[model samples]
Target: MMRVGAVAAMLRAGAAVSLSEPELLGLAEHVRPGAVCFDIGAAYGMYTYPLARLAGPAGQVHSFEPLPVPYRILEAGWRAIGARNVRVTNAALSSSTGYQRLRLPYRFGLPIHGWAHLEEGLKHPGSSAAARIVEVPVYTVDRVCELRELPRVDFIKMDVEGYEAEVLKGAEWTIEQHRPALLLEIEDRHLGKYGRDSAEVAGSLLARGYRMHVWHRGRWNRADRVSTRWRNYLFVSWAAERRR
Candidate 1:
């Protein structure tokens, strides 16, 4: 049976800031039974629960959330559903291991919970939306793997605002060693706010021999160029032996 309450309500409502059911379903297509998956920027466990279910009892799902509010909700939801294979971490993954300020903005008299980001600028700089700054622990994917003694990583789904490049930089070792499939969101405007660019992000992955594909309408389409419009992309490592 599914759990009840706010988390379940949110899941049932299917109200996610930048995620859609089709996208989530497409992501699940990449996961295999007993796979080890990482859910970065896992707000309220929206993708975490589904990922855990996909991974199955023998698999594991590590969910990372920096914001306290969402982290708590994520934890609660995980327990509510009795998901034994999901591990929740209240930290942000970045290019380095340390603490960083996360900017959160409010909208319609309430926090726009999912918009909180570590991109160095507020999404609504001069708008009426209230802003909250919080210092959250940060870890590199390499460090996380080492500390947790993770055996292997099969897939990673990241939606860290525009900090995707930085996160990838930190996960270089893990990516090289495990060659996990990647699902990331790329927004040129958001990257530009922090002196980064989408082209650079895509180029870095391509340099590592990962083929890029765009996710749309519940399917994967090969993308040779980066578009300005915000959307999720799937990067499959050439070294990956498993095929879908």
Candidate 2:
């Protein structure tokens, strides 16, 4: 069961709370019915639920969340909503398959659970305490697709704190093969903690023929270069763009 307070807070906010960005919801509209989607770092099924709903019953949604607390909340929410096509996985996606320690931070006696990352040294914003390290199973996108026999992924929404680069590395094969449209969050400051930069992150996609666009004031603006500030980016594959 989810903490009563948390559940209430979610209910109060409704769909708007989960799909915080207008661009994300707009992107979801692009997913046709019966498309397969992946929601990385799907905390509490916010975006997951909306994506699943948009995909409809014929489609499938695979969501990944490593932390136990949020994972439980996410699973229960799916069950409560009777989302049959949504599969919630209690694992983190990374560059390799195996177990890794996730450092979760605390603030004001409450866990800043969503900010937890695979990098041990990374720090969360706001006043924090010693991190609670939890062992979590990790899977690469390729590994998961191979193991689960997933259909060609049509879209992916990835927001794994600062570990987006590592996750992209793991999904390289999937990206090359599927050329799925991507909604990625970039926080250069957080990436710096993992010895990564925005250019390196954006370069990974650009090298694979992805055009980068940033969401601003309800519209997507093409970005020739990745900025240092934290923001969300839409990476459309060249092939997909051509089709559009």
Per-residue lDDT of model 2, residues 9-82, tens digit only: 35435534543555543655457778889999998866676677667778888999999999998988877867
Which regions in candidate 1 have their CA more than 4 angstroms from the true location? 1-19, 119-129, 228-230, 241-244
User: Model 1 over residues 141-188: C-alpha lDDT tens digits?
Assistant: 889899989999989999898888789989999999999999888887
TM-score of 2: 0.87
C-alpha lDDT of all candidate models, in order: 0.79, 0.79
TM-score of each predicted structure versus truth: 0.86, 0.87
Clashes of each: 0, 0
Candidate 2 wrong stretches, greater than 4 Å = 1-19, 120-128, 228-230
TM-score of 1: 0.86
